[model samples]
Target: MKNLMKVIDALLDGLKRVLVRFREAKLGLLFIINIFKIPDFISDKRVNIINKFRLIFALTIAIIYIVSGIDFIPEIIVGIFGFIDDMFVLVWSLGIVNEEIEKYKKIIKKNKDPKIIEDVDFHIRD
Candidate 1:
């Protein structure tokens, strides 16, 4: 019983941390909508060519997973549970892509160099 209580306490603490982080992010409930804007990120030439390719590839895989009608977890068999894996992939990929886009924009803002935008191969490393 004591071990169970400890486990429960740990779970609660983790939940609290997640809640706090979500609130701090200020992304709102509709933040997922922003993730769907892959084209917007791809259109921005300020982002490096490599990052753009990564975003495009990730988005293509996501689209295939969703539209192919056949996936590692078939929705016809498990209903909503089947979609969970695809959703997880999309959410994870979108988060990474969003971070890359933001980083690229910040670099452009900080440098304010027209040459930086033209130099698609160059990346400002920390």
Candidate 2:
């Protein structure tokens, strides 16, 4: 009876981990989609070679996700391999999105009006 209980507990733990990984992957995909939709990110003036490469890479990964199917390792077994693949893709996509966001933020910050800065500085000193 004790061994059966232990087995049940292990299965539950595995299920929880898989669910968490799935959720993370979904969030990562959403982030990538949002990045692709950003007008500034896709604009001719703002879209550099790196941004283009990142976009292409993300699309390719998404295509793979669709073609390979979510159950790469056979969902019945609940193997860690498939989950690991998803987690890897999620991390890679997140990294790419983060890099692009940082680049965009820097550009926007640099291009901010000098008058805006002067006004803020004057107000802060007062």
Candidate 3:
């Protein structure tokens, strides 16, 4: 019975990791899609119009997943599930930074503005 319990515990641990990875992927995709919608990168006024509506929907899901601790599978049952949530946030944060860098690069390329480019790099360094 003890050995059986050990096996069950191990399986639960693995399951938690898998579920967390699933959540992280969902969050990451949403973030990447949003990055393309930023005003500077997108010229079409229509694009902005579409994205504003999309943003609301995306933000709603993001808020629920982040602010509400209710997981599809309860975190208490599999401890690592919460860690997965943290990982998702970490990845999403990194994606935001990356998107900002790309945005600045585009700005620098378009205007050939040394001051703006320098300012962007300065913030990136700090």
Candidate 4:
């Protein structure tokens, strides 16, 4: 019973941490959701081929990690802990990929409109 409780507590803590990070990285989270729209988003002829490839690669890796069942922490060994590692990796990778996407967006926007001098702020702050 104690062990079960411990596992539950650990899972809750992990969840809290994930939520905190999600809050801090709202733009990244949003971009991850936007992954589904990649085909439409990248349809613009002005979008660089390289940027499109980067987004596709990152998303592919993320999908593979999820579907391959190759986990950093196996559920067989640790009850709830197993899933946390995968979530961490996915979120981390998405955040990175989102940064790249943001950069690409800025380039496209700037090219289309010469008056804009700075990158648009995507950060969501408390």
Candidate 5:
């Protein structure tokens, strides 16, 4: 078991080195980070609605591109490895939507269970 783990670690080290050598990996990493940052954009009250709409539009386009075979010729020629990107995009979008829904639920809960306190002392005596 120890030997197997050692081999796996060696393989990962080599893979990491190769991935760093490839410049596209950094761009892909950034894309992944941006995808996860969707909730931040949604939660930020300071951000413009138009900017948020644009972000959603871009994500929709990315999903369309992944689902359609026109953007990537590999899907046209190689049938077996094609569904990977489609599945990835689907899961990513679902994850973002789920997170936003949870955040909204939290906001609603806070509103429903109000514990208001005013600085001027909101006290009423009959």
Candidate 6:
């Protein structure tokens, strides 16, 4: 029936939106946790010089922009509305820092226990 089809379509759309929101919430939570780890990551020498430099520079700029009055959106006139740009830069930079930290962690893990060739059945290619 037409009514049944409409109901099915509505349900699917609602479900899709819910799934998207859930995914966003999950990523937000991860971002919050990783944001705190920025300091540790920056201090970690194993993260490689390039990654460390990038993380430090990104964080410095974000912090400065958030705290200084010379932002693209001045909070003085717009009140809390000004924080939009500050939050955007902070979140964006923190996201990059988190990604770098994750990459370094993965690299460290892989190097620590490399599974190059261990305990596997082998077959000669014919």
Best by lDDT: 6
Q: List model 3 lDDT by residue over 1-126, tens digit each.
A: 999999989967865765554554454565566465555534533233444444444445656676777765557888777567644544444444344434445555566644544534333553
Model 5 global lDDT (CA atoms, 0 to 1): 0.57
Clashes of each: 0, 0, 0, 0, 0, 0
lDDT of 2: 0.62
What candidate 1 gets wrong by more than 4 Å, as runs, is 1-46, 113-126
Best-matching candidate per TM-score? 6
Models sorted by lDDT, best on top: 6, 4, 1, 2, 5, 3
- TM-score of predicted structure 6: 0.58
lDDT of 6 at 33: 79
**Candidate 3 or 1, higher lDDT:** 1
Over 1-126, each residue of candidate 2 has an lDDT whose tens digit, in order, gives 999999989967765765664555455555556565456666746558778678668757855874676654654477655576565555555555555655666777777654655534334553
TM-score of 3: 0.35
What tens-digit string does per-residue lDDT give for candidate 6 at 28-62? 66767766767767676667889888888878898
Worst 10 residues of 6 by lDDT: 18-27
Off by over 4 Å in 4: 1-25, 28-37, 113-126
**Candidate with the larger lDDT of 2 and 4:** 4
Residue 11 lDDT in candidate 5: 67
Q: Please identify model 5 stretches exceeding 4 Å from their true place.
A: 1-55, 71-73, 113-126
Provide TM-scores for the models: 0.55, 0.47, 0.35, 0.55, 0.41, 0.58
Q: Local distance difference test, per candidate?
A: 0.66, 0.62, 0.54, 0.70, 0.57, 0.72
Query: How many Å off is the CA of 81 in candidate 1?
Result: 1.1
Better of 3 and 6 by lDDT: 6
RMSD of 2: 9.6
Global lDDT of model 4: 0.70
User: What residue pairs clash in candidate 1, if any at all?
Assistant: none
